[model samples]
Target: GHHNVQRLSTVYTSMGMSNADRGAPLWKEKRDTWASVCDDCHSPRFARENLQAMDEACKDAGMKYTETFKVAENLMLHGMGEPMPKDLAPDWSGQHIWS
Candidate 1:
C-alpha cells in the first residue's frame, strides 16, 4: 500500500499537482469513476461515505508516518542511529538493513 501511494504521489507531483489539490475535485473524480461501475449495486451515499472514511484513514496514516520518519531522520542526522553499511551509498534509494 505504501508503494502504491508513493507511485501515485510521484505521478501527481509530476503532473504539477500539490498535496493540497487532493480535495473535492480529486475525490469527486475518484467517486464518479467508482460509482459508474458500482452504483448499480450500492447506494451512492454508502460508497461516498466509505471513500471518505478511507481518505481519513490515509490522512491519519500519513501523519503517523511523518512523525515516525522525523524521529528516525533526527536520529540519523545527529549520529545517534546505527551506522549504515560501508558499501552502501548515502542515498535513500539504496538497499539497506531496514529495507
Candidate 2:
C-alpha cells in the first residue's frame, strides 16, 4: 500500500496556494517539504526519484493545458461558439440556458 497524500502539491496549487516570490518560484522549498515528509518511511533516494517523477508529470500536464487554452481562445475569437450566455434567455431556474 502506497500513501503519499500529504505531499500532493497539485492539490495545493489547485486550492490557490502561493508558490510565487519576488525573484523566482518557490518550487524548491515545496520540493524540500515534500521530500522531508516522504523520507519518513522511504529512503532519501526513493523519495527523490518519486518526487521527480511527479514533477515531470505536472510539467507535462501544465503544457497540455496551455495548448488547450490557446485552441479554445482561438475558436472563441473566430466566433466559433454560437449563442453565448449573453444572448441566452434565463430559464425558470434563473440560470442562462445553453440552448
Candidate 3:
C-alpha cells in the first residue's frame, strides 16, 4: 500500500536517497528490487505497469493531502478550528511533528 510512501518519502529525501535526488542510485536499486519481487507472481511488464500505476496513485494521494492540509491551515489561520495543542504542533525548524 502507499500508506507508508508518504513517510518514506520524507525519510529518504532527508537522507539524500529519494527518487528526486538527482544523483541517487539507492532509490532505483530499491525500486528494481521491489519490481523483481512483484515479477515473481506477474509478468515483468505487468509488474512494471502496476508499479507505475502505484506511483501515480501515490502522487495523487500526495496532492490530495496537500489540498487537505491547506484547508486545515486556513481553518487554523482564520480561527475556525481548535488550536493545535502545543505538544502536537509541528516543529518545522526541527523537521518533526508530534501527535
Candidate 4:
C-alpha cells in the first residue's frame, strides 16, 4: 500500500506518466537498467512480471482519466456544467469551459 501511495504521489507531483515517451531508446535503456537492478535480487521472470504489472496499472489509471475527461467534455458540449464564477480573479477560469 505504501508503494502504491508513493507511486501515486510521484505521479501526481510530476508532469505525469501519460505523456511520457516510453518508446524512446533513452526510456528503454532506463527500463532495462532498472530491470537489471531488480534482477540482481529477484529472479528475472519475477522482475519482468512486476514491471509489466506496474505498466498495466499505469495504463489502467490513464484509461480512467480519459473516461473522466470524456464525461467532462460531454457535459461541456451539452452546456451542463455550473455557471462561471464572476467574482474570481482575472487569472482564474473557475467552472466555465469557455473562459
What's the lDDT of the predicted structure labeled candidate 3?
A: 0.56
Question: C-alpha displacement of 88 in model 2, angstroms?
Answer: 12
Q: Model 2 lDDT vs. the true structure?
A: 0.55
Candidate 4 C-alpha error for residue 14, in Å = 6.9
Candidate 3 structure quality by residue, lDDT tens digits, 40-88? 5677898678767765655565566567778999998998999778878
Clashes of each: 0, 0, 0, 0
* Model 1 lDDT per residue over 1-99, tens place: 112233233322322212233455755565566445546666778767875675566566556756776887899999999867877635453312221
Those runs of model 4 whose alpha carbons end farther than 4 Å from true positions after fitting are 1-15, 19-24, 83-99
- Residue 78, model 3: lDDT of 96
Tens-place lDDT digits, model 4, residues 1-99: 112333323322232436344445656655665466555567778767876777677667667866787887788789997544777533253322221
lDDT values for all models: 0.53, 0.55, 0.56, 0.55
Model 2, residue 93: distance off in Å is 23
Residue 41, candidate 2: C-alpha displacement in angstroms? 3.1
Maximum-TM-score candidate: 4
Model 2 agreement with the true structure over 1-99: per-residue lDDT tens digits:
245665563533531212223123545666666677767678989978986775566556556656776787788889995544754532343321211
**lDDT score, candidate 4:** 0.55
Query: For candidate 4, what is the TM-score?
Result: 0.60
